[model samples]
Target chain A: MHPVSLRKIAKVYHLDAVTVPALAEVSLDIRPGVFTVLSGPSGSGKTTLLNLIGCIDRPDEGEVIVADQAVQSMSDDALSDFRARHIGFVFQTFNLLPVLTAFENIEYPLVLAKMPAAARKKRVLELLDAVGLAERGDSRPGQLSGGQRQRVAIARALATAPKLVLADEPTANLDSQTGAAIIALMRKLQREHDASFVFSSHDPQVRAEADDVIFIRDGRIAGVEQRTAATQERAAS
Target chain B: MNTWLLALRNLLRNRRRSLATLLAMVVGLTAILLFGGYRSNILYGMETGFVQQSGHLQVQRRGYFLDGSDNPSAYGMPRYREIIDAIQRDPVLAPMAVVVTPTLQLGGIAGNYSAGASRSVVASGLVANERNHMLQWNDYDMISYAQPLALEGAAEDAVVVGTGVARKLQLCAALEVANCRQTPAADAPVEAAATGSPAPDDVLALSALEKAQQPRGAYNRIEMLAATASGAPNVASLTVVKASNFGIKAIDDIYLAMHLAQAQKLIYGAGRPEATAVIMQLRHTAQMPEARARLTALLASDFAGEPLEVLDFQTLNPMYRQTDEFMASMFGFIALLIGVIVLFTIGNTMGTAVMERTVEIGTLRAMGVRRGGIRRLFMCEALLLGAIGSVVGLTVALMVSWFINHSGWAWTPPGYSYAYLILVRVWQDVPLLVGSVLGMIAVTVASAWWPASRAAKLQIVDALRHA
Candidate 1:
């Protein structure tokens, strides 16, 4: 079964007196345990589609099925619980709580999930090591470099071990070298953890690394491309 | 997860703003407490003064309080001694009544024979020891208003006159009254000289002609003249012992005190002696209702068929109630104003915090924090602010009270002749202290509700894009 499925989902935003269509007629299925990329330029409804799939924003029309539950049929509080358990989010700005340390930031979602403190501490430490920031756990976001802060954000997103991890232009703010390293790290973690990883990015490095690439334009999917095993091996090369 | 710790960390994020908000609450609470303390001090002081001077309760004839001064002899309690005995032996009043005594009131003319001057005077006759005991009543443990009468142990002819009376009768120098200024127009036998009327104050001349008599001496002595029960003129020679001020000029000008015999001899000569009022001092002011009720019952059952009434200190002195109400209103007004200022101060601080943390709120909401959870965090911050502010405010208030009490500050009341030490009483007043502290903290917490609600209702998508 697909980890995230959007069937004819539409989202409209009202900015004062103007109503703009952010996404329309978007139907897609994200296969589990694979790296997928939603490649689109700015204002192409990439972030809007990610928001709907993560259950943070509701679609104006159609069904958003994430983790086998139609999100539109749930109450706000129930949707929050569902998100805490089944989906994680990564923002382009690396939105870490400034008042908390790196370890606490990763542990925040587990706390929201009401995980036992001992288990939370264990999971947070493991994720800290996986993100290559085991020594930086005690440092706040203000004290970390841009690359290290993004790594902490990724660790926090994966702390609850959700079935789906959604990233909105995850590498938009980093340099070419840091963005490549982050993409490689995400790819390695997805292969090992076996969770569906969906990123909204137009970067060539991110597009080259994905097992499936969906092209979107003007809130519509223009095409979908799935690589074979040999094609994926060539892309890896 | 420890939400309180998160709230504390958020509070510590902007230290200066939090400090400013806390300072507003602290100052507001401190001002309210100090004002309340001052009001308590004033009312307590007034109560102590009245209780010391006249006792907590007085039993008098039915019309005595209103018209007793018109004819003190007519309203005299003839069976006062028996009534005093009954009250002193009563079951309820026996434990509460510290000093139950009888006093005689008379309106008469006092002639200072040696000075050759006389004036109309209002006099009270009492047992010097009993009056002296009544002078020491201070139930609130406040500054003492006790001043023992010098008439204690003195001869029956001895008397105590107010400083105004001394000046009125031209006895200031003789009484050794410092700063005594005499207006000559009110003194001397000037009325007779100007109008050619028989000098009404010529007690010696009148004594010889109208069969009036004085004691055979030319010392510091006065002859009290009053019409007896039969309307016959009578006189008793009194020796002046001490002159004391009664604080109010009107009462001081005509006030005098003498032994009961001297007063009875002058007013009820050759007749049954009586007292105009019986004074009963109690252990505390709070026991007034029970004392008044018990005394009323005793007056009705034991001393039935007699026209008498029970009057508490507050009733006898309406000035205490007026002053109490006036100061209370002033205190409440000031407290409300300060509370409003504190309310808005805290609300503004929290509102600014919500504005600054829009993105953080969006991030938190996205991480599965419900709206109620967002509201709870801000409320926790307000509770912390209130708690800290109340404690520090109480400490500051107590320190201020202590400083003022030990500083020897004194001010004369509106109609008083002398200044008293200014004091602040709060700690012993449990209701005022606790109420003020709780009210302060409650206001602090209440002030944050609007901001917390607003923060909780923000749209997560919009908040995330605010930056």
Candidate 2:
């Protein structure tokens, strides 16, 4: 089964008395173990579509299936449990809890899963090493650079060994060098963990490295592009 | 991070605001405990005084309180000796009673011939040695109220008049000086002629006007006169040995204490022994109910089918009962007021903290923290705050109480003529400590509920966008 299957999903938001359509007839199949990027200009409903797939919100009219379970049929608690067990999320702002150290932030998802402390500790150390911040495990989010914070958030998102990692503008706040490094780290971790990654971005560099780039415009899927391995390598260089 | 650990770290984020909130809690708690301690002290003092003044239990004829006012000797407890013996024989009662003494109350007139002053007085005849020693342990002024018993010195006819009675009669150190009645200093020792003929030197020093006041050189002669139980006139021309200040305005105005036998003979008749009541003192005031129950049972079994009533201090002194109730109500109101202020302070603090952390809350929710987990985190924070504040407040309260107790401050309650030292009993007060601590914690948790729930209910999508 595909990691995510969206069939004609639509969402509408009401601001005061004004009705605005954020997504309409958005259909997609995100296969496992692929680095997928949803690319569009501002207000192209890229984040909205990502939110629907992550189960943070529901669509106004459509079927949302994540990891072979239809989320609309699940209760709130069941949906949260499903998300805790199978899905991970990364926000545009990094959203790292300020009070937690890098290690603790990374271990948070495992803690929510009620994992054993020894295993949690082991997994958190591994993730810290994977993110190239093993020496800075004790540093809080505030003490880290933007690239370092994003790395911590990325490690946290993969802590539960989720089937899919959904990221919204993960490199939005970093400089060009830091953002490029973050993207390389995410791609490398995606390959190492064999997890499908679906991230939204307007950056051309991100679209170039994507195995599949879905372009959305006016709340609809405007086009799709498939990149060859050689093209991806050429774009990365 | 664990939830509780995260809560603690969050609390430390705004240290100044948290500290201010903590201080409010500490001050509120300390005020409640100290005020409660003060009231407890007052209650303790009043109870000890009342019980010591009129023993833990008093056994009197059934009608004594109601009808004995007109003819007190007529309602005297005829079987008082039997009741005392029974009290000693009972296994449950014998250990409870420390002192059991019979007293005779007589109403009469007292005259100071040297000062040409006379007044009506209420007299009590007590077993002198026991009565005098009992007063030594009393919480009232030992100097003013109990010192006069020493002057009697086995003189059966001598009397100790109340200070109010003495002031009214103008009986002074001697009649040698004029203006002895011009508002005599109330604290002067009762120095007068012996309970016999005066010394020649003392008589010689008397002014001519004093001489005219008392003929036959019996210048210090004070006469006590009362009617026998049969309504026949009886008189005892005795000398005033000393006077006492009983410390109660109503009692001080008309009190006269004499040897028990003399009072009995004067109020009833020669060779006739009678007592108005029997008073029982106990080792501890808390043993009142048990002791009273045992004594009353014994009294019934000994004098079965007799008209008698045994009463505790609370029943005897209804005014003290009312005063205790009033104090309890007043303190309750104070505790509630303090509790509400602390609750609102904590509630407002938690509310503001939750409002400021909307985005953080959203992040937590998105990370699979359940609503229940969010609520638990806030509740845990409140509980920790209460626990810390209670410790500090209780510590300060105890320290302040110790300081005041040892500071030697004295206060005289209204209607009491003598001053007593201020004291606080904290260690002995388990109920106050437990109740205050629990009450504080309960109020703190209760106050955090609304704010925590509000935070937990915030929609993740909206909270993420909060600035």
Candidate 3:
């Protein structure tokens, strides 16, 4: 079964008395083990779509199925449980908790999962080394550079071994080299974990590297494009 | 990290705000504790004074409480020995009894023959010498009363007059009426004539004339006149012995004391021993209620068909009870005020905390931290604040109490003669301390509830977008 299936979803937001459409009649399916990107201009509902897929939000009208379960109709508490078990998230600003160290940020989800202490430690240590910041495990978010902070956020996202990882403009705050490196690390981790990677971004590098890219405009899906091997090779060079 | 550790780290995020919030809690707690401690001291002092002055329990003919002030002998307990014996036999009352003294309540006219000094006074007659030792040990101000009543030597047949009565009669050092010739020149200061008496402007000169007309030490012969229970006038002449200060101005102005037998002879005629009341002191104030109840039952069984009432100190002195109730109400209002102030102070702290961590909350929510976990985090934070504040505030309170106690400050309450020092017994106040601290913890946690719920209920998209 597909890890995510959205059927004719609609979402409207009211800003004061004015109505705005964030998404309209959007239908999509995300397959397992694929690196996917929702590419759009600002205000085109990429983040909103990612939020709905992550189960952090629900469509105003539609069926949202994640991991063979109907997510849109679930209660808030049930949604929270489903999300904790099935989804991970990374944010534009690398929303690492300021008060927690790098290691703790990675360990947070495992703690919520009620994993045993020894296993939790082993999982966090492996993620920190995979993100190439094993030595910076004790450093708080404030002590890390933007690139390092994003690495910690990525490590945190994969710590729960979720069925899907949802990131919203995860590289927006990093330098080009750091952004490229973060993208490379996320792809490598996605392949190794066999988890579907769905992220919202306008970055061309992200679009070039993605297995599949869905383009959105004016609150609706514009087109779908697959990355050819030649395009991936060109982007890597 | 554990939730509690995370809460601690969050508190450290804003050191100044956290410290300010902590200080607010500490101050509120300290205010409640110190005010409560000071009031406790006031109640303690009043209780001690009341107990020493009137004993813990009193037994009398029902008529004594009802109307014996008018004719004390008419309501006298002629069989007081039997009642005292029964009290000594009761299992509850026997062990608790410290001093059980028989007393005769008397009212009469006091005068000196040679100096022609006269005044009306109310009096108590007791077994003088032993009671004097008892008074010396208990009444804090009794040390100032000149030489207690002794049953022999120069003091035999002598009555102790109150300072007010002594001054009224122009009695000298030995409480003798003024006689310049009989009083050795060295002992007589002539101050009565030199300074004149303290009187109102219109009567000041008249008082001076009266002082001059009397000599020092001549009227050693003192007389007491009263109407017996049968309404016949009776008089007894005795020597003025020692001037006494009972600390109460109203009592001092007219009180007299003498031997119980002498008073019994003067009022009820010789060979008849009668007492209006019997007062009992207990080993501990806590025992008073049980003693009163058990003794009342014992008295009922012993004096079947007789009119007798057993009264506790509180019933006999409504003023003390009224004062206690007033203090309780005032302290209760203060406690509630402090509680409200602390509540708002903590509520504001948690509210600011929720606002400051919006994006972080959104991230956690997206990562699947439940709303209940968020609420629990804030609640733990509130609990930590209260616990830390209460421990620190209790220390501050103890220090302040020690400083006040050792500061050598003393005050004389309205009806007291000597100044007493302010004392704060912090160690003895464990219940109040524990109770206040626990109450503060509960209040602080409760204050965090709405803010915690607000934090937990934030919309992930909106919260993440908050600047």
Score every model by TM-score. 0.88, 0.86, 0.87
The docking category that best describes candidate 1 is medium
The 0-to-1 C-alpha lDDT of every candidate, in the order given, reads 0.85, 0.80, 0.81
DockQ, Cα level, model 1: 0.63
- DockQ of all models, two decimals each: 0.63, 0.61, 0.77
The native-contact fraction of candidate 2 is 0.53
What value of lDDT does candidate 1 attain over all alpha carbons? 0.85
lDDT tens digits, residues A91-197, model 3? 99999999999999999999989999999999999999999998999999999999999999989989989989999998898888999999999999999999999
Best of the candidates, DockQ: 3
- Pairs that collide in candidate 2 are none
Show where candidate 3 strays beyond 4 Å: A226-237, B113-115, B127-161, B175-221, B238-241
Candidate with the larger DockQ of 2 and 3: 3
Clashing pairs in 1: none
After superposition, candidate 2 runs with Cα above 4 Å error: A7-10, A25-27, A59-62, A73-75, A218-220, A223-237, B66-71, B128-153, B172-221, B237-242, B270-272, B292-304
iRMSD per prediction, in order? 1.0, 1.1, 0.7
CAPRI quality band, candidate 2: medium
Best by lDDT: 1
lDDT of 2 by residue, B1-467 (tens): 67778888988888998899889888988888887877777776667666656777889888786678546667887677888788878888888777788888878877563444567798888887766555545442221233536434757777777667766666655323222353333222223423323333422333333334545745445667677888865667665666566767688779888888888888777646878888888877778888878777777777887788897878878878898899889889988998999999999999998899898888878777878888898998888889989998899889988898889998787887678677766655778889998999999999999999999888777788788
lDDT tens string, model 2, A40-133?
8899999889888988788999999999999988876687788888888888899998888999999989989999999999999999999999
